[model samples]
Target chain A: MKDYIQKMQTGGDIVSAITAFVEESKKINEDNHYFTVITEAQAIEQAKNIQKQALTKKFPLAGLPFTVKDGICVQGVETTASSAILKGYKPVFNATAVQRMIDAGAIFIGKTVQDEFGFGALGITQGKGFQAPKHPDDPELCCGGSSSGGGGFTKKIPGAHASLGESTGGSIEAPAAFCGVVGLCPTYSRVSRYGLLDYGTSLDKIGPLTKTLPEAATILQVIAGHDKKDETSSQEPVPDYAASLGNIKGLRIAKIKEAFAEGVDESIKNSVHEKLTELEKQGATVREVSLPSLKEGIATYFTIALSEASTNLAKYCGMRYGQSGSMNTSFDEYFTKIRTHHMGEEAKRRVLIGTFARMAGYRDAFYNKALKVRTKIIQEYKQAFKACDVLSSPTMPILPPKQTEAHNLTPLQHLMCDVLTVGPNLAGLPHVSVPAGKAGIMFIADHFKEEELFRTHAE
Target chain B: MITQDVLDKVAKNARLTLTKEEAAQFLPQLDEVLTHFSTLQDVDTEGVEPSFLPVKLSTEMREDLPEECLTQEEALKNAQSKNGYIKGPKSV
Candidate 1:
């Protein structure tokens, strides 16, 4: 594995690597790891081009093969957000991140499955009755997601070096933890979101899910930078992420008390605790810290994410975009019929609830209040950072539950699974979930501190 | 509780449609989610500003120089058109 990654980074012997990637990607697709796998012709064409470039120039991510989540558009590819509504929407342009990866000489093998419009915490709850990607650790377990297929494929496919995933709350981290892979959720706008289908504009971010922290950092180095097309992207300078991978002598790590609150499985907590103990033994100080507002992060995140989604998705009403509706009595009737028939129950529930929260009477009570609480969450994180270098938590509160059990959970119970992750997401902090056992440990840092986040947990 | 009446009003506001049976099924589930969101009432966010972005943000603009863009044919490629115009409901 070490030799393979080293050769990939240096653009050495790429023909065999590309062949292996295509073969392994096809094998993994048998288990439903991909929504659309790139054709062998496309893979070979890209590989031959990169091999020719290896004679003189060396790109940072040369020869690396990666998978993209379905929500991020790939040019000429069937880029649906795993929704029946976008049934045949092939993008005309590449997402800025995808284009950057291609320019860096990385090969894309396929796009992975996700929850429709990224609304569900459980990976199995897609609109078209698509099965969830099986967990790499235990085939019977649920691959926790919105980024479910990205996490699953990266964990199981040896040929693919990384995966491109998008997250609103815990979409990337949850599946990463469940599949026992490394997932990084960069600071908001750290990577451009110009081509990503919006889940929640204020909360959405594009990130990488990889098998190791170093590989995640390498992918980040290639993908993270401001783009002229994305107005919200930060002007902050991108750091040399790979340079920050060594020596932690006296860093303060804050283990969040709220992560161990009731309902978290004991074994999950013990696994994260063991990792923290090991860090402590390696000259790092571990202290218990409390962010009381973190307890309400789930509710606040949903209020904001759902409201934004209702507006962002309003453009897909079977008009010029998305699959066209046949019932054409009137424009309103056409839209109503199309959305009612094509949209899933989860999507309808979210749109209705979001419209309710944005209603005249309820707007102040729900949407406005959630925004204020979100402010408090950000402030709490800022205050926490004043004392600690990074905040630590179990990426998910429990291990990967069986798909049958996950299917039986109530809507609120499913949302509660993301309690540990939504705080960082709501605050737009840099967070990475590193595999610890069957689950993972998450480290969060202040905005634009991704190097610090990777440095503390690269072990 | 999210009653059928409430669902109807919300569906109308969102330009979406749902059957009576579907509305009935989602009423209680949506009500439970709203009830959970009620926990935000406990925080005394009296003077706090609403957070649209966690960090201070300002949009960076590019020069408005004309560049290559999609042609008329390419722009209309995804549409369901009757002739050269996009097909839609009859207007007055």
Candidate 2:
């Protein structure tokens, strides 16, 4: 990683990185590791610029090589969101998170794959004209997504130290769990969302996926904090996250019983249980806690997610921007053709639910009620946190299903995989999903207390 | 109860075209989903304040100030089509 950084500092171009990445990616791609490898000369220019800043010690992320989910805007490069509608669309301004990383001296390695528009739990949801990519270790397995490419790149892209990905439900955690990496989903508004391509606005957050918790902490320190461009950004002072990594002795942790139930895969449950035992041995107090609200998390998550998604996606009419097609004489015809031609199955699915829930008669009955229920769910978590300083659970109920098996599962079944993740997202709490043994376990804390959570669980 | 027709309508409204076969497959699945959510109804939240953000926050109200924003040209560069105002597909 240091050599890669030095290479960039010494005027090494992105072409070299791209060449190395592509060669490495080809091997991984044969194992189904990635979807596409970005090869534009512009990446070289970006790397060189970042390198110059790094040499001056002006940037925290100087000389670091990173990948971003394809959904994020990187000026002059196609921000596909893994969708065909915006296949060649290139943004002129960077997403606030990407720009921040760039300003911190991080080199852009490439754009990684995602479920189209960061929509799905399983990584396979691609937009019109695209297909889901597979995993590096097993072609039949999934990489876990809407941040699949980012997760895949973290594992397979040679000399690539870390990557940025997004999460609505478990996009970051699921992939990290499957790929055996560290995924941090900061409290909502922890990172600015200025140029993020939306799927679910209220729940969406950009975060880092890295090999270790310390690296994640460092990356979060650099990319986090307020950006005026993003309405949802929090103005709170970004804490010294790296400085908080200390001894975990005497910390209180609660293991959610629902996350380790009979329905959970045996191997994953056992592995997580053993990790908790290790944490106990390390002087942390661990006890089982019941969170009945979590059982409803997936359903409530979808209600809120889809309702938000419906309105958020309305901006994609082909007449203004994005992919356009045959001219329609009527307004309805125009929308139908553009959306019909552009949106993938998953995007359409959520939009329909969202639109219906937000419709005139149904808004109060469905959308508002869902929000009320979401409030109640949040309350439950707040109450739970009173009993423990941090909450722990398996990131996913089971190991990632094979990509082929993923398509076979119903969408609701797929959503169930996020049962452990959605609660933290709904409550706007900070959480980190770290690799523990084979499966990943999530550690969640009250909002803005991510430092506390990370300090207690660093491995 | 989520029915096949409801599912189909939801799918269409969302702009997804699903075969009858797929609808049949998802109907029971969605029913199970809603059934699971029924668990939340048992929790009493009568007096609890709805938590919007986990952290207590007050929206920062700022005095109007000039700030750098992407030029209209730069913003429109990514737009599929543009006129004086950003153009989107006509909606009924």
Candidate 3:
């Protein structure tokens, strides 16, 4: 991976690597690893552009070939969001993040697959149309979801260093954890959402999944910061994230008491505890922190997310930019027929729950109540952070389950899998899931304090 | 307590047509999950400001500027059907 980066940086023989990967990508299409590959001509032009930038001393990404989830728009390329409804859709403009990477001299390889509209926590929602590659160790196991192809693509291209993905719930982290890669879910609005398909607009965040923490940090540095196009984009200066890595000697780390309790996989729990002990030996302090409200995070997250999802998805009626010609007698019929025929079952489930929550008489009962509950949950996190510089937990309660079994989970059962992740997302805190022995260890910190979290991990 | 009817209703609101079997399967799970959430109601939050974000934040604004948007063709290219004005099913 380092050699690939260097080649891209130096502009030497990088085209071969890009070409070989594109060919291999075609053969490995079952993983839905790539929706489209840049033609050789396009790859050469991108390399030339990087070389020109390097000559001018503006090499941020140099020639690094990165892939983005299809949900994000790339000018002239299809942004289908892995749904058959928008199979041939192409964007006329690039998402802010995509444009930033391009200006930094990064080569766009292709768009990766994702759960339809990024609503599922498991890759199964990509539907039977796009096949995800099985786990490397266990063929029957899932590769993780929403960003399934984004994460799965990392394993396929030993030469392609990192990829960008979006997370609403556990998409990036879950897939990264299962695939043994690093995933960074930046603070909400740290990256732009403009030009990306929305699913739970308030909860969705764009992040990177990379082979190493350093690589992830590099990508984050490049793509982060304010965007005029996205109203929610933060205007804060993007921190020197890579510069913060080093001795974490005196940092304090807290492990949520509930996360390691009953129901967690024994092996994963042991691995996390062992990692904490190692950090302690390295001179860091570790303690147990109470975050009682965290137990309700998943429930609250679904209520809030699905509620927003219902509204965000309302634009996809057979009237605007998705599957059309499915029905036309009435607006409601058109919407029902198009959505029912095109959206995956998972998308439908969330939309229903969201709609019900916002229904006139029930809004105060469900949506307003969930918002109140969300506030309480956030307060719990703030208090917990005061006692510790960084909080640690297993990235997932269990490792990736079999795809068949995952598909069998009822919607509620599947939402339960997001238990460990929803807390950080609800709080809009910065978190990164790094390899912790055999399982994954997620380190979350106060918003805009990602540097501190990295320092704690390094120590 | 969540019932099959409630599950069905939620599904309908979500624009899903759940089979009777699916409603049966999901109802009990939703009940058990909500029972677990009931524990959170015990926490004392009186007089505490509900937290919306982990870190205190003020919305930051960017200078307003005119920008280009996706062309009608580019925007509608992915639609299954298009009439140049909107994307949807063919009109009878």
Candidate 4:
């Protein structure tokens, strides 16, 4: 991140930096890491424009090139969310976050691939002229997803600083961990979701996947603010997130016991424990804290996410937007056929799970109970915060699965991958996944407390 | 386990169509996903409020005022349309 920004400041040619970076990206992308790359000519043109502006004044992110996840809407560009239903659908406007990045002088290289409709965690659902992004470190390993491309490109290509990734249950952090980059999923309404294609309305958050903590903070500074377009966006004051990186002296850090519970790999647990111990050596008070409800967070997260997804995705029926079906048939038949044919297996499964969970007789048992558990989870976080300033956990329980292993896993097994990261997301706490060892440690802070996350992450 | 009839009803409600083979494959998978959720029943959430969001949210309404929106051409840009209208299946 600092590397790209330093180039322009040291009198280097912005166009040359971007052109070389795009070429490098293309070389790696040939291995199928990107869903789409802005044509070399288009990227060069945008770089030339930024060069002209550079002659006059400097912006915080001047000439930084980033990729938009396919789920994010970019005006006149294909934003497919890796789903065939919206394959050719080019949004007429940029998503609020995308527009903000452009306003900060960041160039949009192109959209990155992801799980179709952000459905799967392993990012195995690759379609629409692209395959799943290969893990940068190991091609044979899975790219933890649904923000797979953002994590892949940021780590694989230098001079390409950061990419925006939306998280619903660990999408941002999982990929960041697997790809060995840093990702911050701000408290649920910290960044506006005005332009992201809805996955789960309540759970979705737009964030940045970058190589360093400060870069994530810098990008967050640019994009985090209340937008009238997104009613869920907080009216809370936007702080200088990058400016608040203080030493981790005298901060209360809680190591979540459940985060290292049964299924987690021993190495992943040790790495996070080592980081917490190091913070303790640096004058931070570290203690073990348990959120019993953590055991139920994954299940509750899926229930609420899928239930909202089922209703949120109902708008994709062929009667309006998305892939058109047999128009000569009755509307019901047309809608059904388009979904059946164009939507992928994960999308179908979630829609069904969500539909049944919200059904009359079953609503009380599944959806309602899930919501109640969600409350308990939130309360648990609130209670834990009373005892500690920030909580620590492994960003992922295991290393990126082998590509073959990821493909062979069942749905339940796939969800188990999110066990560590989902709890903070469910509670709307601001968390940063920072590289520690093979995997990463997540610093989870109370709601709207992004500053503490950065301060702790710096240590 | 989820019965075939329940699976069919879910597909219909979701505006999706499924083949017999697809249904046969999904029933067991769906059953597995739901079985995972059975743990939620063990938690005593007796008097808790259903949490739709992690933070408190209040509905913020905007005044109905005219503003620039997608032009008709842009509105129908991604859909199959005729005469500037988005076309759909026959109502009959």
Candidate 5:
């Protein structure tokens, strides 16, 4: 990350560099659907501002360009979260993360595409008028999502660039793993979600997807902190994350026993185990530990996430913001019309399931039961952390699959892709996914212990 | 398990109008999803208070201070609006 700022400081021609970057970005967006909107004009404008002020010496992220997940607001930029219902709705102000990154002098590149409302793992669930992004490596393979564009863009961007990725359940990690980049999700509330279109209020977190671990950390340092605009944002002291990359020696790595069983691909297992062995040889201790409640992770996470999401998405009725239909109808019919015509198939399905879980009679059975299970899941994580500083698992059970595979799965099966990533999410622990072998390996640290994740990942 | 009748009711409650094709495709899938998630009931969560957030939270209030804010024009920029208010569907 510092390399880009250094380059901008010494390389007298900033305008030419930015122009080439935009040209390359346009080509990549066309080839892979990596960006929903490439802010070429905005990027050039910001570049000119940097050149005029010579801000590289004053700002940490000066001259460093960053891409935002579509779910995040970027002032006048169209932030649709890849959903048709929100099409043409440009926020008047920046998301807190975007504002902070800009404050640190990161130039806005563009908004990246993802599953509508972050409801899918395969990147195939884009709303109407948006195409699911293809894997950067092989177009036939699916890009992991819902931060699919962030993952792909980070990998494709040559140097000193980062993408701000939001995760509710493994969105950042999945795409990063598939694209072979560093996807790090901070603890829930670690980064304010002020301008983000909500998915699940309790679970959503904004973090970074970068080509290198240190860049991820550097971006997090800029964005993670208290924001009064977001009530849930943490007040915990922000650490110097870029400077906190310490040796992993003596750190305990507790490998989850359940993550490697049954359905995981052998290639994925071999890669993570190889990393574990490498870490052990580098003086870190590794042990097999079981968090049995994790077996219920997918269930607990989806139930709570969807339940919260159902309510959060209720705000997108046609009149106040986003897509609108003719107003010659009753409120109910108008809402139904706008939603029916604009929302995507997967988005509608999620709302239905979420609404059902929180309805009367079923509320106690599904939503409430899931909430209790969430507590149990958190307890299990706490128990495991008692014996270990960091927990280890494969980021995903399967490698990035064929593009067609995303279409074949039932809704039940599709959500299973997030099984390994949800436990840490449910408990609000910090987790990072690093490129391992064919996929990426994930490590979870205790709440407020993002330093531990960076330290161990530095190895 | 979710039935068609339940789905229709839930969809309506959620302000969604599902087509016959959508309902047909999702009805069974939603049922199976709920059945799969029913496994969470097997765990003993008796007496466990639900954890809405993993971290402790307290209400954060800033001084009741006036600050420059979005203009009405800017606030209504994304919405269908006229005469300084967002236009909406007819309400009783």
Candidate 6:
């Protein structure tokens, strides 16, 4: 990313660069099916304006181009979150983060495909009619999701590009690990969620996926902060994220003991441990810490996320945006028809389960209990952070699985793929997944302390 | 405990129609996931407060000031409208 910026500073023609990029992306996007919509004309126009004014060095983002996950609204662009129900719907306003990116002069390239409504851990559950993005390393294997397409595109594209990815549970991290990119998911509400299609209202966060940690930090500097547009947006002051990009000499790393336990592949553990030792040579300390509530992460996460999702999704009836069906039937029946026809299998599954969980008789036992359990988990993490600067673990339990392997998994198996990631996500902590050896080693920092994630280096 | 009847009722409450095959296919799987969720019952959360959001956030109230907002055209762009208002199924 810095190299690309240097080129622009050295009088590289922004228009020419952006035009060539769009043409290159167009050729590659045809075969990969990662991009849902490439905003070539808009991007080139911005590039032309930037170059005409000779303003490359003036804007922090300069000529850098970034992709947005399908969920985040880019004004006048279809923001479906890859769900068929919202295929033709374009928002009137850019999401706060996207607006920030544009204001900082980052070129908007395209939208990438994702799991329907950010519902799946594996990329396979793209809303019916959308193709799931594959791992950049191999076409046959599935990229992790629900920021699946952005992860692959960020990894595959060369020279100074990033993707703005949103995460409910482990959407960004999982895909970053699988696609071998740096995915930095900020603490909940650290960035505004305004204009982002809601999944789990409280759990969703917007972050950047890039090839390098510094690039991720730079994007965070551009997007992270309070925005009145998102009521849930934090009132906390934004820190100098770029300033924190160096020197983890005294950093303390806490290895989540359970993360290395059974169900995790042995090679992943060794690789993550190896990365930890390498970080130690930079004078960082490592220690094992027990987070017992980690065992409850997956169940607790799905319970809360989907329950919120069901309510959030209720707004997508035939009367509003997205899909509309025959109005001849009663209102309820009409809505049922539109949703039944448009929502994918996973979407139906999540909504039904969410509805059942939030039902009167079961709400107390499932939804309420999950919330309390979440509190306990948060406390558990707080206790762990007391002894260490950040938590360490393999970003995914297993390496990126083949499309066939991902296809064969039952719903339960697919949900469990988020085992290592859901812990921090459920806690709403800031975390980043950096590819290390055979697996991605994820470093998680406490809520609103995203700068700490930058202090640790990848090299 | 999510029986076929419960699943149907849940689907109805959510305003989502599931074909008989979908219901048959989904019910057992939903039951399986819920069964796993049932394990949470064993966690001792005797008096723990629920964390609705992980961060402790206070209610933020904005002054009710009207500013330039989405124009009617923009607001109704995605809606199916008869005149200007969003169109809905017959209510009469």
Q: Which pairs of residues have clashing backbones in candidate 2?
A: A113-A149, A319-B88, A319-B89, A320-B87, A320-B88, A321-B80, A352-B14
Cα shift from native, residue A340, model 6 (Å): 0.1
Which sequence of candidate numbers ranks them by TM-score, best first?
A: 6, 5, 4, 1, 2, 3
lDDT for A239 in candidate 5 is 84
Better of 2 and 4 by DockQ: 4
Q: What is the TM-score of chain A alone in each candidate?
A: 0.97, 0.93, 0.94, 0.97, 0.98, 0.98
For each candidate, what's the DockQ? Answer: 0.65, 0.44, 0.37, 0.76, 0.83, 0.80
lDDT of 3 at A36: 39
lDDT of 4 by residue, A1-459 (tens): 666676674555889888887878788898856655465676688778887877567767888888889999988887778888887778889899988998887877888889988887777776544677888888888888999988888888865478999999999999899889999999999899998999899899999999888888899999999988899999899988876675588889998988878888899888888888888887789889988888898889999999999998888876555677658888788888888888888789888999988999888888999989989889889999998889998999889888888888888888888888889888888898998888889999999999988887654
Q: Among all windows of ten consecutive residues in candidate 1 chain B, which has the lowest summed lDDT? A: B83-92
Every candidate's chain B TM-score: 0.79, 0.78, 0.75, 0.81, 0.90, 0.88
> Lowest summed-lDDT stretch of 10 residues in model 1 chain A?
A1-10
DockQ order of candidates, top first: 5, 6, 4, 1, 2, 3
Minimal lDDT window, size 10, model 3 chain A = A30-39
**i-RMSD of all predictions:** 1.8, 3.1, 3.9, 1.5, 1.0, 1.2
lDDT of 2 by residue, A1-459 (tens): 445555665666644565465456556655554655554355567655664555556556656767888888887777778877776777888899888887777767678878888788778887776656777566687888778877766876545478899988888888898888889999998899889988777788999998778778888988899887886789889888877775588878999888888888888888888888888888889998888877767767777787787878776766555677665466566766667677777776667666766666656555556666778778778898898888998888878787777888876687777778888988788898888777888999888788876776545
Alpha-carbon deviation at A201 in model 4, angstroms: 0.3
Backbone clash tally (model 2): 7
User: What C-alpha root-mean-square deviation, in Å, does candidate 4 show against the real structure?
Assistant: 1.6
Angstrom error of the Cα, residue A312, model 4: value is: 1.5
- Candidate 2 matches the true fold with a TM-score of 0.91
Output the lDDT of residue A195, model 3. Answer: 84
When summed lDDT is taken over every stretch of 10 residues in candidate 4 chain A, the lowest stretch is: A32-41
What value does the TM-score of chain B take for model 6?
A: 0.88
> Which ranges of candidate 1 are over 4 A from the true structure?
A5-11, B82-85, B90-92
Task: Give the per-residue lDDT digits (tens) of candidate 5, residues B32-91.
Answer: 999988887788887999888877776768799998989999999988887999999898
